[model samples]
Target: MSTLFPALALTLFTPLFGGLVLGLVRPMRLAGWLNLAFCALSFGASLLLARDLLAAPGGVYTGHGLHIDAFNLPLIVLTSFVGLTTAIFSRRYMLEMYAHGRVTPLRMQVYHAMFQGFLLTMLVALGTDNLGILWVAVEGATLATVLLVSLYRTPESVEAAWKYFILCGVGIALALFGTVLVYFAAQQAIGDPEQGLTWSVLHAHADGMSAPVMAIAFVFLLVGYGTKVGLAPMHFWLPDAHSEGPTPVSAMLSGLLLNIALYAVVRFKMLADSALGQSATPQLAGHLMMGLGLLSFLVAALSLQRQRDIKRMFSYSSVEHMGLATFAFGIGGPLATFAALLHLLVHSLTKSAVFVTVGHAAHIAGSQRIERIRGLIRTQPAVGWALLLGVAAIAGFPPFGIFASEFLMLNATLQSWPWLAGLLLIGLAIAFAGLFRNLQPMVYGSAPEGQVAVRANLWPVVVHLLLVAWLGLAIPPLLAGWLQQATRLIAGGGF
Candidate 1:
């Protein structure tokens, strides 16, 4: 076996194997610890794989039906790292839920099991070289998350789960049709029935594929995967799903899952743009992405002003950040694409940390309602301060990773489309103001009596924010190189 095989095996299968064992094992005062251990191992493996790929010539991992490159190595690393931190945070959160009788032993087992399975699905989606396999993995993720979302079995939770299922199911079906259309275009262009819809194969011949066919296929794809990305008009299912799910799941949704969906869109967008290069289809796909992305960003920014539920508010924030990232990618150049890539890492780390604080605050406040939760500076200082830090980081404050990425995006926009850059600034300013307006009162308002937080597991919160802080101050050269290479690959094609 290649040296890559072992690390890839560990990175890909450990979570599924752990999930199987976790499901079978009895919950021993809860085995959340086990989940943490598994995620740690997978994170280590992914890190190793990334390091090796970087050291490897061409920064590629080919063969074995897997295609790991500059583009996906960062994403895989991000997913694994976030999975570990979320696992660490959940160990504390779920144990508390069990103690309070909000979760039973069996449900805890299921949660741990499904959490690992969810990780497995994303790794699969990220790793697979084939579009069909990618679609399968994404669909698998939907199933895994639905169980996690409804783990509480509350009527509302179940309703949210059902809604997520129905919307994503329709979306997935459309994606399948899009995939078939891609294969049809590929088959016609490549004249190879055996090769199927492997991305490497499709990419090599994207220019030769039918423009009209590629154009229409991309529209379906943008809508199909864009729904899961929570772009507005297709975003109705997202807030409810985030609100009703466990906080850990909410973190995963915003930090990891949404990124994966957007990654899919990015993949298809690249393929669509390449396939129709220099034709009447000129920038049509890019225009579609920018249109939807701007719509989502502006609408979600306004929607955030109305949120009373903390999770729902942050969920909208996820939409806003995702839209911004999408818009950057849709703009499509070295700086813009690099900004989008960096934003994925920054947003995932920061938003997840924010959710950890949100989870802590909800428990401490005895409610997820913003009106009911007051005086975080008084009632629970640690949770309150952590929440403040997280909120500020997420709001793109100075000296944060988001700030760096957003600045790069604006600089890129001004150089190209100064008018759209104005819209981007307006959207971002509105979002920033809306988040502060809601969070200010919650953080600085009068303290509610009779509520207290448990001494929280602040480690994950500290670690994640610190990492984002580091990125903001200065992204390490190696990481910057990786982001730049990935951006170039998206813009100028394969390295």
Candidate 2:
């Protein structure tokens, strides 16, 4: 067996085992430690898999219904790493929630179990090669997160969870239709059910599939997955979920889930592109992506200025950033795709770090309201500065990875569709203003009387910010080459 087989199995099954074990482990403290341990083991295995893939010729690994290639290798590693850090952060954060009577022992049990399960689903979604399996994993993630979102059992939390389930449930249903359509096209082209549903096989035979069917399928797929991506008009559940869920759940939703959804969209795009390449409107799929992405970007940007809750504000920021990344991918070139990949990495780092900081901030002020959470610098310097820097990184400030990616994306836009470049710039500016307007007072304004510091785990935020800063200053040669390989995989060439 390939070394990749064991590493991938460990990376995936560790979480599965952890989730099952955690479900029955009633001691909240013990469960928390186990959750962290499981995430750490998964991250370690992912690193080993990354090393194995790098050493292997052609940077590809395939076995047991899963595929690892240049495109997903980085994402797999990223997902595991973020999951691990979020686990670390939550160990301290959730315990505090428990102490404060915000979470009961049983709820904590559910939270830890569902957290591991969520990671498992994300890993399965990223690692699988069968499109049908991908859909199931994503649906599993929805169920897991729905439980997480409603852990507080508050009226609003329950409402948010139900809203998330209904919206994403409908969205996933449409995605199922799209998946069936893809399978339909594949059957006509390849004539074998098993091989036809395999993504690699479909990609290999995409040109032989029906263009019209693929075109309609791409529409359903985009909207379906795009809803999860938090793209505009389909983003109603996002802010509520972020606001009502635990902060850690907010981090995963913003930093990770949206990317997985976008990853699904991109995979389908590859097949759609190949199928539509010879059609009369060759760029139909790309055009559709561009329109939705741009619309999401603009809408989220304007929406940000109106958010009163700090978490909701950042959630809209997630929408804006995801939109930008989507738009870059839609541009369809080496530079744009490279930027999109980088944006995904940096945004995940920055947003998760920001949420970690926000969690602490809310704890400090005893509220999530923007007006109530004042003078974080006075209350807790570490949390305050981390929030400031994280917001700066996410807002596309220089010397952060987000800025580098956005700059490249802008350059690509100017080259490909100059007219849309203005819109991108405007959206960026508006989002920046929206974030800082609320953020500045929170960081520097007067603290309320009797407000005191809370114990915070700043290590995750520190590590994530440093990584984002390092990537901005210079992409390490190894990662640069790896991203270039993924760029080639997605765009058919390297920059």
Total backbone collisions for each predicted model: 0, 0
Worst 10 residues of 2 by lDDT: 1-10
Can you write out model 1's per-residue Cα lDDT over 12-32, one digit (the tens) per residue?
A: 899999899899878645478
For 1-495, candidate 2 gives per-residue lDDT tens digits of 457788999998999999999999999888989999999999999999998889888998776899899888888999999999999999988989999899999889999999999999999999999999999999999999998999899999999999999999999999999999999998899988779889988888999999999999999999999999998889999999988999999999999999999999999999999999999988888888888899999999999999999999999999999998898899889999999999999999999999999999999999888999999999899999999999999999999999999999999999989999999999999999999999889999999999999888899999999999999999999999999999998899886
Off by over 4 Å in 2: none
lDDT of each candidate versus the true structure: 0.88, 0.93
Task: Kindly provide the TM-score of model 2 when superposed on the true structure, using C-alpha atoms.
Answer: 0.99
Best by TM-score: 2
Per-candidate TM-scores read 0.98, 0.99
Q: Candidate 1 at residue 185, lDDT? A: 90
The predictions' CA RMSDs to the true structure, in order, are 1.5, 0.8
